[model samples]
Target chain A: MIDTIGFDGDDTLWHNESLFSMTQERFRALLAHAADPDDLDRRLLDAERANLKVYGYGIKGFVLSMIESAISVTDGRVPARDLQSLIDFGKAMLEHPVELLPDIADVVEALSHRYRLILITKGDLFDQESKIARSGLAGRFDAVEIVSEKDSASYRRVLERHSVAPDRFVMVGNSVRSDILPVLAIGGHAVHIPYAITWAHEEAEPPDEHYRRIDSVLDLPPLLAAW
Target chain B: MIDTIGFDGDDTLWHNESLFSMTQERFRALLAHAADPDDLDRRLLDAERANLKVYGYGIKGFVLSMIESAISVTDGRVPARDLQSLIDFGKAMLEHPVELLPDIADVVEALSHRYRLILITKGDLFDQESKIARSGLAGRFDAVEIVSEKDSASYRRVLERHSVAPDRFVMVGNSVRSDILPVLAIGGHAVHIPYAITWAHEEAEPPDEHYRRIDSVLDLPPLLAAW
Candidate 1:
């Protein structure tokens, strides 16, 4: 039996990437003069990749990269109001509501009694803590870890914290790279719940059959029961 | 004997408030026309107080509060470039070097084998984790927790995680509000290493006389040795 179940906060349980998408559209318009929408998008991704080490992931880093991209892409011709607008977009994203994906609440409620449920997310500490506080699912989680990145070492640490080995720990998340691959590599069980939108950085070709894949978190309960 | 030692990261182990001091000077110059430096400082503190529940601590929230303070103080007349400058100041603060406070490194190194050390700091997760990673102190800590806030409950949780009660736990830090009082309230031993500069928000009266105080963290090892 699975002793603990780990959930990814953004996109898996709630609408996260969609907010990033909405803000990216605003960004494309803000820099329309600097480059075409497609070109601007590519450049922004490039900036994010380069700044990842310096800023890490989350809204603060994202906002910084947006500013850097805006200034560099426009050759420093971007208006001050436009700079403020980029900051505003990030502020709006941080303040955005945590919209739970269909049946997530129900699944969490149903699963709480049977398994130890924890939130293992990576991002800006403040943003993730704020989101978790506002997510209204706070009291339900047994543990919450806001980490810098999701990797093999992170999974191993999580397993140690939960006091369970790979076979006894299961993960449920939206990203193949973060939620599934690393957990499987550690010999833990994983389930992929497909989100409507995934961050480009989180996308990876699905690993060969060690874990289950379902249409939604809504279907997670029955699938776990069968296992 | 103290079985576990908890160290507050920012101002205690490394230079933190001084960076804020430097940034505040810049903020004052940027908004000099809006209000006097004293007035701006007061308003920013007010903004930080109001947004504490929303943004928490660390550079990101500090920067947001600074922006809000600027807009309100200037009657919305603050220049967009000035606003960008505020964001830039925060970015610079996060990127600031972790300058070790006088004898912190030696104290930690001396006490590592004798105590179960954990770095219990509250702030933006990425920034704190990155600082700890770069500070060359990670090897000394058995555990590192980047919390959203520090309170009686937080201290209690930390003790529980370390599998100890109040008498067996000891904490050392710079802030009366965050580092000292909370630990004392929970019946744990505390040491206050007074930093010359402190954020207005973290200012508070010394609560009773149960804990000890020293001029520098360098004094910590001898103090711990006696206790």
Candidate 2:
């Protein structure tokens, strides 16, 4: 019997990557003269991947990487004005209001009454905290963890801190790389709820038979009930 | 009665503000042609204060504010190269090695064996985590909290989560605004160990007769013993 449920914040509960996608479009347009669209995307991703250890994940890092990529792809010719636009993009993304996925509010509220709900996310500390506050679902969570990354060790640490045994916990998230695989590795059950958009870095292969997958968080209640 | 002790990172455990001070010197040199030193400092601080809500605290936010300030101070004519250099400044600060304050490692290690030690510092999560790991004192900390801000409310929440009462808790750190006042506000004991350099934003008038003021964390063990 699972007494605790871990929920991923970004694409799992609300609209997140979509904001990044929209900004990337703006970013590409701002630097259209410097590089081709596909090339720009590749360079931006490469910069993000390279800087992950240094900058970590978040709008701040994304904006920094975009600025860095713009300079590299343009051979230092990208205008300071364009770089300012990238900074503005970060500000807008950080201020963007949180939008909950379909029926997620009701689902979370119902589940919160039964299980200890933890909203686990990976990103800039301020960005994640603001989103949680704006999500209007903050009251439902018994705990909130804004980690820098999600892996087996991170999962184990979080569980240990909460005094929850792995076998009695269930993680519900959108990214298989972050939410599903790591939890399963730690002997916790995970429910994969595919989101409409996934960041390239979060893409991963689906696990076979070990965990369940649902198209949306709306289906989570019935699935948990049956289990 | 104190069974738990919370230690602040940054300048309290290692060199932090000095790195920023050195980077600011480089930044000033980079934009020397555009503005006066005093004026530039004011502009950067203004930008930082304005962006604090959106950007929070960290090297990434600091770098972004620097770029913004440079553009404003230069009337949007700050060169792309200068902006790139600012980004490099952030990267360097993040990758910089951790230097524990004088006798901090031994002080923390000694305290850890007697009391539950929680490294509670506010800033970018990833950056703080890296600094903790590099400090070679991570094992001494029973818990680590990388919060966005340190306040009475945040302190109350952290202690409650750890099942520690404020009366039985003592926080040691460099900033009175962050480490001393807030913890004391929540009925907890706080030790203020002033760092040589304090960020302007972290400056506050010293409190009278409420908390202990030590020259350094080197003085911590003896003070606690007397208490």
Specify the highest-lDDT model's number.
2
Task: Please write out the lDDT profile of model 1 over residues B1-227, one tens digit for every residue.
Answer: 68889999988899888898899999999998879999998899898887676566778778877877887787666665677687779878888778988777887998898888999998877788889988999999999987888999988987886688888788888888888898989888898887887554665566555588888776778888888
CAPRI band for model 2: medium
Residue-by-residue lDDT tens digits, candidate 2, B103-213:
887888888889999999999998888888998999999889888889899999899889999889999888888899888888899888888985556566556444798
Model 2 vs. true fold: TM: 0.96
Global CA lDDT computed for model 2: 0.89
Clashes of 1: 0
- In order of appearance, the predictions have TM-scores of 0.89, 0.96
Give me the runs in candidate 1 sitting further than 4 Å from their true place.
A30-35, A73-79, A199-209, B29-36, B39-43, B64-88, B198-209
DockQ of 2: 0.80
